[model samples]
Target: MYELTVVVTKVLGTCSSEVPMKPGDYLTVRNGALRIPEGGHICLYALQSLMPVLTTKERRIGEKHSDDWVWRVHHVQCPDPEGRVIFHIVRSGEKAEMPPYTPSEPCPQPQTDPSLADLRVIVEEVRGKCTSGMQPGDGFLLKSGRLYIPAGRHFCLYALQATLPLLPAKQRAPLDGDWLARDNHIICPDPAGNVVLRIERV
Candidate 1:
């Protein structure tokens, strides 16, 4: 799926301009006629791509409804395709901040020996710091930028894809162990950034 970058905007007196928003902020449309999500703002890109039925409403309100677009936040039912929709907002500086990697050498090959102990790829440095670390048995945490896998927890290849709905078809692989890794980094398909999930041999 593709992403649409939408910056929040505000108006003071006669001037109107874009504004920064945090995760907790809410978004509305059609003069608060529709509330995108209660606590988390809906990712317009996801809403358009994943749920075909919802696209009409989003397009109508965002593009065709009215030019005024003076919306006030209100409570309304959110259309969740599978679960609650959570949007991840990363600044331009943060998206450009990639983890240090060796430029000359290629990425390490996946372990193939069955006799060797299975490596547990735990969530190491998510955006340079680990926020609530996910346990191995916790399965997959689907948050956009929050990295997972480094606590040496073994996860099935199928389980990893379940967390990343936006991952391109080309990147989907059936085998386990950092299948997303390239150039010494394993990147996940996040709306905000190509998040580097930790990959370590344990």
Candidate 2:
């Protein structure tokens, strides 16, 4: 995957990134920075992390920014012959690899309503200070320039790999073979901050 950054204007209102990508190009949001003007306010919609993942067809990354938000949107051209692409969100320090293209069965089409799919789990609240001691089913969501994990629990990588298929088609990383090696699970770099996660439909 190729790494790149796009700086969205603060006041221009709903700025689109200059990244040159077509219909099937896969994009992943790895990091971001928001520059809010003094006395300016950041909106709840702008603070959300799942916006980029769910958007397609003239893809937009964020709500109209009151401040400049420079987000790192990594790109990878679709290697499959069918002109289909897969996106993945990985922790900063984890290994990055292309998901294999398996040509046997067709991939499940993504649902319009994310809640109707089993692939997403929204974070309702954090019980403690960004806890990592979560149960086997817990997972983190990468957005808002931070890795948001449960406040008081640790989530295991093995458990995450097992649960990936449960994510909505859009949220789950596409894998050909050896899904465990292909899936990228995110974790909070810091264990002090708290956050709520909403599963975005692919």
Candidate 3:
């Protein structure tokens, strides 16, 4: 991230930096300037930190500017990706990565959806992604971004057992071998990895 110095030569209204800010990218409020994390490309949504599980990130500038640097926005420009013309800044080269947002809990172990393996090889590939992927209420690594399964009563996985009877025709049971039995017990991971069961039909 680039740092901008306050100058008396110019009337600072909403003084910004030379760096073109983006969404998902984060900046820290500092004494003299803001620290913009390098390679922190912005996304439409804010990244989830260990705290504030349900908070939506902000991108707009402060309502009004004051002489006090004590209060400032760690501005994250999450503009409409399709739209052009966001903001302007000076220019600077010094940059580095920002500290990662601490995770509230360790991510779950890797998982697989056997049903996805049935049809096309490509389908399996995508399903495999969703396997290690954060469940509806879990969070883990997803390639570059950290996926957070939203935490709330309304989240889908909160009602998994309720979904099974309605399971689509192609995925009524374990896809591969009949190794997984309804009456007998076997390991089957819930889609989000938050739950694993030695499920029995009884």
Candidate 4:
């Protein structure tokens, strides 16, 4: 898999958090693991906004002027209207192997892990037209690392992508003064869609 680094390129507005984000703050995704600087943190909202395109940005684009959206776009903005944090995603030009897991070994169940919490991600509001036909109260459950959408119900792919990167971190016990620990909302990247989803520990 390709390694991608997300760097904070600029902060147009003050971060709502006590610890303001600076241009040097960054996180890297190698193989499938996330790495952050020691004692460093990235805003959940900012990270969520980048989740939709990080995987695509990891790949090499053969054509420089191709119409591929990933090739054309490089910057992503945090959903916070006040913070306006800008993130730049670029391929590190490195390849990495995903950590090996033995198929024979049983995965740790969520129930067995007292520290892990199941989560419910629900649509709190749709500020603009949602092409997916989503509405307030639409939701899905995350348990034992599996997502379950109710039968006969649907979740928007774009909205779901926005929340995927944060779910694993939210499931674990948050570190002291972690901004992600206090944040519970993620906005869909669609400018027109403006779907807001709330995360709740269940």
- Return the top candidate by TM-score: 4
Name the regions of candidate 2 deviating beyond 4 angstroms.
Answer: 1-75, 84-120, 128-190, 194-202
Model 4: residue 109 alpha-carbon error in angstroms: 9.4
Superposing all C-alpha atoms, what RMSD in Å does each candidate have to the true structure?
Answer: 18.4, 16.7, 19.2, 13.2
Clashes of each: 9, 14, 5, 0
What TM-score, to 2 decimals, does candidate 3 have?
Answer: 0.16
Q: What tens-digit string does per-residue lDDT give for candidate 3 at 1-202?
A: 2333211121123322122222223333222112223333221122211012111111223444474332242222222243332222222342423333322333233423333211100111122223323232221112112222222211122222222222222234555665433432212233433332222211
lDDT of each: 0.29, 0.32, 0.25, 0.71
Worst 10 residues of 4 by lDDT: 96-105
Worst 10 residues of 2 by lDDT: 35-44
Compute each candidate's TM-score over C-alphas: 0.20, 0.23, 0.16, 0.48
Give the poorly placed runs of model 4, Cα more than 4 Å off.
1-110
**33-108: candidate 2 lDDT, tens digit per residue:** 2122221221212223323432221234365544424234333223333422223433334465644322122123
* Per-residue lDDT of candidate 1, residues 142-181 (tens digit): 1222222323333322223333443332123334555444
Report the error of model 3 at residue 117, Å.
Answer: 19
Model 1 quality (TM-score) = 0.20
Candidate 4 per-residue C-alpha lDDT over 1-202 given as tens digits, one digit per residue, 9 for 90 to 100: 5677777777899866434566766666654334554434556566667776876776667766576777677779988899897877767763422222211222344365677687999999999998677899997776544455654566665677778888989999898999998999999888888999999999
**In model 3, what is the error at residue 5, expressed in angstroms?**
28
Cand. 3 Cα-lDDT? 0.25
TM-score result, candidate 4: 0.48
Candidate 3 shows a clash count of: 5
